[model samples]
Target chain A: MTNPTAAMLVIGDEILSGRTRDSNMHHLARELTLRGIDLRESRVVSDDHDGIVAAVRALAAAHDHVFTSGGIGPTHDDITAEAVAAAMDTPIGVRDDARGILAAHYEARGVELNAARLRMARIPDGATLIDNPVSAAPGFSLRNVHVMAGVPRIFEAMLAGLLPSIPGGRPVLSQSVRVERGEGDVAEPLADLAKAHPALSIGSYPFSENGVTGTNIVIRGAEGAEIEAALVQLSERFGA
Target chain B: MTNPTAAMLVIGDEILSGRTRDSNMHHLARELTLRGIDLRESRVVSDDHDGIVAAVRALAAAHDHVFTSGGIGPTHDDITAEAVAAAMDTPIGVRDDARGILAAHYEARGVELNAARLRMARIPDGATLIDNPVSAAPGFSLRNVHVMAGVPRIFEAMLAGLLPSIPGGRPVLSQSVRVERGEGDVAEPLADLAKAHPALSIGSYPFSENGVTGTNIVIRGAEGAEIEAALVQLSERFGA
Candidate 1:
C-alpha cells in the first residue's frame, strides 16, 4: 500500500509578497519524508479569510491529511482559527480548557490576558489541541486538518507532537548519483531506466555553478534494494 | 488599479518529497514583488502528467501571468513541455528554431547533440522562447504561462529576460517596525490599523530568539508616503 498523502497550506501575505523567505515547508517536507509519509502537494495562500477557507476545504478533500501553518495567533490578522472554523462549518469559541492553559502560561509570565490574547483559546468544535512547547497558544487538529502556527519553531514543535499519532506507511527511501554530465547528455539512459522501473521516482535536478552545468539523478522508492539496484544500473549506464 | 495577480507552479516530486528545497518560488516571488506583480498563490505538485497539466491550466486561467519551474529538461521525467501543451491545448514538436539554437550551442562546445539532447528543442506552438543565458535550452512563454527550468540559477537568468517583456504595475513599497512585545500585545492595534487602512496590507510577524519574543509589524502598499504614514501611526500607537 502507498503512504498516506499530505498537502500543506502556508498562509500569509508576508510569504506571498516576498517579505519573508519561508523555511517551514522545507522543514515539514524533510520530517514527513523521514516518516515515510508522501507529501504530494503544497500551496501558499494570502491571509484572506475566504481564500484560506476555500484552500482548507479543497486541500483537505484532496489529500489524506492537510497541515496548515500560519494565521493562528493572538492578533487582529490572526484569522486562521475563525476561517478554519468556517471551512469545517463548526462553531468556534474560547474553550475553558484552552483558556485555562493560556491563563496559566500568562500568569507565570505576568502577562495580561486581554480579549485579543484570548483569541487563541477559540477552538473549533470537536478538534484536538496540538501542543506548542515553544509557546502556550496551542494548535489544533480538526479532523484530518492539522492547523499549526506559522513561526518555524512553533510549527516544528507542534508537528513533533502531532505526527506520532498519525499512521504512516513504510518510509520512502531514496538514493542519488550525481552525474558530471549535462542533463542533455544524460537524458537518454536516464529515461530508459525510468521506463524500466515504473514504480520509482527518478528526478533529474540540473545545477550550474562556476560556469559548469551538470545533473544529479535521484532515485526514490519504498524498497531500499530497489533504490540500490537503480543506482547501480544508472552508474553503469551513464559510465560515470 | 491593483497589481497584476500571478501564480507559480513548481513541478517536481523532489520538492514535494523534501529531497530538494524549492528555491524557484522564493526567487520568483521576489522578482514579481519588485515588478509590482501580486504573487497571490504558489503550488508544488509532483511530476505527474495530468496533475501538471491541470495545475498549469488552473493557474494560467486564474492569474494574469503564470510561471512554472522544473520538468523542462531532456530526461524522461521531464514532461512539463508536453503537459503545458496539453494544458493550453496546443500542438508541441521539436521546432526548427529551438533545434537550431540547441545545435549551435552544442556545436560551439564540441558536444554531440543526440536524440535525447534534441528533446530540449520541443516547444509548444505559438509560444515565444524565454532566453536561458546559463544554458542553451530556452524556456517558452505560451500566452500567460512562462515555463522555465527548475534550477535556481537558470530560473533567475530566464526571469531576467522574461519579466521585462511582461507588463508590470507599480512596485509595492513596504516598511516594518520591530516591536519589543508579544503578538498578543500588538494584535488590537494591528487590527485597528488594518481596518482603518483597508487598501494596505499590514502584517504582524512574531519572532523568538534567545528566549526573547518580539513582533515585527510590516505595512505594505503601492504608495511610499502611505506606508510611511502607516509606520508613523504604528509607532505612535504601539509607543515603541
Candidate 2:
C-alpha cells in the first residue's frame, strides 16, 4: 500500500519578513518520513487571511493530510483559526472544552484568562482538539487538516500525539553512498541505476568541502532489500 | 511606495523527502528583505516535473518576481530548467554561450565536458544568464522568474549578483523590544500600537527559557523614525 501523502502550510509574517527562521517544516518532514507518510509539499505564507484560506483549501484538497503551523497564538496576528475555519466552510467560535483547558492552565499559574488570551480557545465546529502539553491552547483537527502550534517544541509535542492515531504504511528506508567525484562524472550511471530500479527514489545531492566537490547518492524505498540492492549497485558503479 | 513582491519556489526531492534541510529559503528571505523586495510566499515541491511547472507558473503570475532554486544541476534529477521553460511556454536547448562557459571551466581543470556535464548548458529561449561565480554553469532569468542553483554557496553567489540589477524600494527597517511577559498580557496593547502605526508591521514572537515565557515585539517599517517612534510607544506601554 502507498504511504499516506501529506502537505504542510506554515503561516507567519515573522518567517516571511526574515525575522524568524522556520524549523517546524523540517521537523515535521523528518517525523512524517519516519512514520511512513509521504510529505509531498510544504509552503510558507505570510499572515494574510485570504492567503491562509486559499493555501489551506488547496493543500487540504491535494493531499490526504494537511498539517499547518504558526499563527495560533494569543495575539492580533493570530488569524489562522478563523481563516482555516472559513476555508473548511465551518463556523468557528470559542468552545467550552477548549476554554476550560486554557482556564485551568492559566488559573494554576495565577494568570488571568483575558479576552486576547481567550481567543486561543476558539475552535471550528466538528473539529477534534489536539492536545498541547507544552501550552494551554489546544490545536484542532478538522477533516484531514491538523492545525498545530508554530513553536517548535509545541508543534513537535502535538505531532507526536497526533501521528500515533493515524494509520501509516511501511516506513521508508534509505541508504547513501558517498562519491568523491563531481556529480557530472556520476550523472549518467546514476540515471541508469535510477531507471533500472524504478521502485526506488535515487537522489544525487552534491556538496563542496575544502575545494573538493563530491556527491551523496541516496536510494530510498519502502522495501529494505530493494534499497540495499540499489545501494550495492550504486557503490559498484561509482566504486564508492 | 509598496515594495515589489516576490515568491520562492524550491524544487528538490531531497527537501520533501526529509533528506536535506533547506537553508536557501531563509537566506533568500533575509536577502530579499535587505533588498527591499517583499517576499510574500515560498513553496517546496518535490522533483516532479509537473509540480515544478505548475508552481512556477502560479508564482510567476502572482508576484512581480519569482526566484527558484534547485534541480538545475548536471544530473538526471535536475529537471528544473525544462520544467520552468515549459511553464513559461518557451523552447529550451543547449546554448553556445552557456556551453562555452562550462566547456572552458571543465577543460581548464582537465575534466572532460561529457554529455551529462554539457546538460548544464541548457538554457531556455530569451533568458538572460545569471553568472555563477562558485561554479561554471549559469542560472537564467526568463521573464520575471530567476532560476538559480540549489547549492547554498551558488545560490548565495547568484543572488548577490542578481539583486543589484533589480530595482528596489526603500529597505525595510526593523527594531525589537523584549518583554518578560506572556503574549496574552501584551496582545491588547500591542494591537493598539500596531493600529496606531498603520505603516509599521508589529510582530510578537514569544519564547520560553528556563521556565520563563517572554515575548519579543519587533516593529518593522520603511522609515527608521517611524519604527523608532513606535518602539518608544511600545516601551512606554510595556515599561520594558
Top candidate on lDDT is 2
Cα lDDT of model 1 by residue, B2-108, tens digit: 77999999999888888889888998899899999999999999989999988898899889999999988888888999999999999999999999999999999
Instruction: Give candidate 2 regions above 4 Å deviation.
Output: none
lDDT of 1 by residue, A128-176 (tens): 9999998889999999899999999889999999999999988988888
Find the 10 residues in a row with the least total lDDT in model 2 chain A.
A231-240
TM-score for every candidate vs. truth?
Answer: 0.97, 0.98
Scored on chain A only, each candidate's TM-score is: 0.97, 0.98
**Candidate 2 clash pair list:** none
In candidate 1, position B76 carries an lDDT of 89
lDDT of 2 by residue, B149-169 (tens): 999999999999999989887
Give the root-mean-square deviation of each candidate in angstroms: 1.3, 1.1
How good is the docking of model 2, by CAPRI class? high
lDDT of 2 by residue, A1-240 (tens): 788999999999889877889999999889989989999999999989999999999999999999999999999989999999999999999999999999999999899999999999999999999999988799999999999999999999999999998888788999888898999999999999989998988899898888778989888898899888887887788666
